[model samples]
Target: MKPVSTWAAMLSLSLAMAGCVTINIYFPAAAAEKAADRIIDEVWQLKPDAATKEGAPSR
Candidate 1:
């Protein structure tokens, strides 16, 4: 029971430290294009109705 409490305390401290740091990574345009293609393919595969709705002109 004592070891469990100590481990939990240590985990909380580690998580607090992890929240202090930030990371920003910018991907290249080619990678973004590939990802967009994949997302579009999946969305169209799952939701053709949504595709038609998006294509329709708004009044």
Candidate 2:
């Protein structure tokens, strides 16, 4: 019974320590900015609806 309790305590302690790990991730700002600009340009290049061509008010 004592051995089981000791084992349980160690496992809980190990799990608690495991939860404290830190992960560092780095993002490349230049690459992200380039990708965002490309997406924005593609979106802006799309043609407007036909209603707008006739001078109708766009919703």
Local distance difference test, each candidate: 0.84, 0.90
Worst 10 residues of 2 by lDDT: 1-10
RMSD of 1: 8.7
lDDT of 1 by residue, 9-33 (tens): 9999999999999998989999999
**TM-score: model 2 vs. ground truth:** 0.59
Candidate 2 residues 1-59, lDDT tens each? 34568888999999999999999998799999999999999988878885599899998
Best-matching candidate per lDDT: 2
The clash numbers for all candidates, in the given order, read 0, 0
**All models, RMSD in angstroms:** 8.7, 4.8
- In the predicted model 2, the residue pairs found to clash are none
Highest-TM-score candidate: 2
